[model samples]
Target: MDYKCTLDNADSFLNQLKLHRDRKEKVAVLSDLGGWERAEGMIREIVHKAGADYLVLDNGSALDIAKIVAVNGVFKTDCSC
Candidate 1:
């Protein structure tokens, strides 16, 4: 289902999503809050640059920040010479 989230609650919502017990319970971001518009835009741009198919958070199953790190190549594997 979809949920309306604000900056105050965004972290909580994503954290709950990560901690969700039911695998079938689908939670998606319903709408972007005015207070978080700029942050959302930045996130959307980053997701877009990461080759996301769409800008909506609902397009994905989770909204955790870890997803961003994965997309932004922060977890790259390196080989030592």
Candidate 2:
């Protein structure tokens, strides 16, 4: 199943990955770390999907993600191909 993953907020990107994993979906995120917030259970689902090893590239922070959304705004989902 191919699904379009779009984040509506910077910090929520990882959360999105977690959301995806809650349904047992594998994903990879490549983006910034500064935007990552330390919220509880923020990465619980992600950690569970670690078998697939969904990564958040900070380019090194160990705490990062591919955020289509960066704070004051976000990206729209378009799955037309």
Candidate 3:
């Protein structure tokens, strides 16, 4: 299942991660913000800790991100607005 979450709502995102932990689902974090390297890195660490295979698309366009996610068959988790 695809999860739409914001970095501001970290609890909800963690909950979602927990729910999928057993399934060993792949997680993809997409962000268009150019100045949030620290925030992005934090989320990446969280995803790593969750033991989920992840892909990060930093400062990418919608179409490019979509294509990559589709090809990867990963669960898209938006962590940025």
lDDT of 3 at 7: 32
lDDT of model 1 at position 5: 23
What are the Cα lDDT values of the candidates?
Answer: 0.28, 0.37, 0.32
**lDDT per residue (tens digit) for residues 1-81 in model 3:** 946433332222444444444445544433334432221211222233244433332332122221222122223344323
Best by TM-score: 2
lDDT of 1 by residue, 1-81 (tens): 933223332222333333332343333333233221211212221122353323333333323242321121112122111
Ranking by lDDT: 2, 3, 1
Instruction: TM-score for candidate 2, please give it.
Output: 0.30
TM-score of each: 0.24, 0.30, 0.28
What's model 2's overall lDDT? 0.37
lDDT of 2 at 75: 32
The residue-by-residue lDDT of candidate 2 on 2-81, one tens digit each, is: 55545434234545555654665443333334443432222333332444333333232243344232312233343122
**Candidate 3 to truth, TM:** 0.28
